[model samples]
Target: PSRSATLAALDVRKRRDFTVHDLDHRHHLWHEGDDARRWAREAAKRATVVLGNIEEVEMATGTRNPVAGAAALLDLGAKIAIVKRGGEGVYARTASEEVTVRPVEIPVLNGLGAGDAFGGALCHGLLAGWPLRRTLEAANAAGAIVASRLACADAMPTLAEIETVLARKVSA
Candidate 1:
C-alpha cells in the first residue's frame, strides 16, 4: 500500500477535487522527501479538498507535521484539509480555523477502509450542502457504521443509516 500513494494521488487528481501529495515521492518502499514535496506542491496547485491518512502521509512525507501539511493545503488555497486519525478522531482545517471531531463509541469489527468511507461520506455530505458540523457528524457516524460491521466494503453504511445515527434519535 505504501508504494501506491502516487497512483492513488494521481487518481484523486484526475477524478476528484483533491490530489494526494505523497510526502514520499519515489516508487521505492521508502519515500523520498524532495520528490514528495514536489508532487505535493503540484497537488496543492490543483485541488480544493485534500484528504489523507495519517499513516500514508507520514510514510511518504517522512515527517508527521500536521501544521506543515495544513500549511501546504493553505498555500494551495484549499478550503478543507482532513486528517484521519483512526479510533482517535478526525481533524479538519480551513484557512481560518481547525476542528477536531472526536469519534463516537462503537465496537471495532474491521478497521480497513473505515477512513476511506469516512472521507467519502464526509465529502459527499459537504457536497450535498450539509454544514461543516453536520458533515463531520455524518462522517463520524459513517465510521461507526463501518466499525460496527464485520467487513470493510460491505460494512459501509447506507445514507439512511448515516442519517439515523446523525439524528441521534435511535437508542442502543
Candidate 2:
C-alpha cells in the first residue's frame, strides 16, 4: 500500500498495531504554522514506531535533541522513536531506555537512498524480533552498503551482504 494511503488509514483509526512511519522531511515541506505542527504531532502520536533524521525530528517535535524529541513523542503515544544521525549513526528511544549506535564507515559513492535502506532494515529487524541494538546495527550496515554503491534500488544489498557487514563489525 502507498504511504499516503496508510497514513490516511492511521489518521482515521489511530491504530497502534506495528505501524512504522518514516518521517521523510521532504514530504512534509508543505507543513507550516501551528496547524501543521499540530498535525505532525498527532500523526506521530498514533504510530507504533516513528523514524526520521535529526532535522525531521526537530521539525516535528520542535526539539534539537533526538532522544528528548523522541521522549516527547512517546509521551504523545508512540512506542518507539528513532533519530537517524548520518555519520553519527542512530539514536533510539523507548519508555524505559535510550541507545545510540555509532556509525560504521565505508566508501561513499553516493548518499541517495541510504535512509530508505536504513528504514527497510529497521523494519526487517523489528519484524524478526531482534533487539533494538541489533536492529540499529543491521540498519546502519545496510545504509552504509547502499551509500558505498552508485545506485539506489538497483544497489540494494542482499541478505548475505547485510550479514557479511554485520559479521565484519563484530570481528572489528
Candidate 3:
C-alpha cells in the first residue's frame, strides 16, 4: 500500500477514528513504484506526522542527509518528522522541537518486524499525547526489545516490557 494513499484515506476518517495522522513512505516497493517518491512529497504535505527509515526519508524528501531529509519533510508541511536510524538510534523533529534517542543496548537475534514495533510504539505515543522525545525513547526501546528476541510479532514487547527495559537502563 502507498503511504500517500493511505494517509489521504485516513484524512477523511480523521474526524471519526483518529486524531493524529502519520505517513510512512517506502523506498520503492509500494504500488506507485518510482512515482511513489514523488507522491511522498505530497503525502508529507498532507500529513501532520511523517515517520520512515533513512531510505524512506531520503526517497520522500529527495535528499541524501537523513537529518536534512527530516527537516525537508517538516518544511513540506508535516508537523513532525521521525527518522529511524536502526542501530544508530532515532531522530525526530517538529516545528518547535527535535530529539535524538539513542538505541538501547541489547543482544541481537532476529531483526524482522522491528520496524513494526517501532512504528506501533510511535503511534501509541502520539495517540497518548506523549512528548516527542519521550515517545522516541520508548519506541527505541520497543524496537530493541523486538530485535533482541527470537521473532517479530511473536516477540513484540508490551509497554510494560519496554518500560522495564528503560527502567533498567535508567538505573544502570
Best by lDDT: 2
Question: Model 1 compared with the native: what TM-score?
Answer: 0.70
Candidate 1 lDDT, 1-172, residue by residue in tens = 5425655555556635433332322345444544655555555555566666665445434446765665555666567766666676777788787877777777887877676677778778777887776787788789888877889987889899888876662354
lDDT of 3 by residue, 1-172 (tens): 5554666675674434222334455334655435766676765666677788887788777776767988998788777788888888888887788898887889889888888888889889878888788788898999899999998899999999999998987787
Poorly placed runs, candidate 2 (over 4 Å): 1-6, 12-14, 31-35
| Per-candidate local distance difference test | 0.65, 0.82, 0.77
Q: How does model 2 fare in lDDT?
A: 0.82
Q: What TM-score do all the candidates reach, one by one? A: 0.70, 0.88, 0.85
What does candidate 2 score on TM?
Answer: 0.88
Clashes of each: 3, 0, 0
Model 3 lDDT vs. the true structure?
A: 0.77
- Residue ranges of candidate 1 with Cα displaced over 4 Å: 1-34, 59-68, 168-172
RMSD of 3: 2.8
By TM-score, the candidates rank as 2, 3, 1
Better of 1 and 2 by lDDT: 2
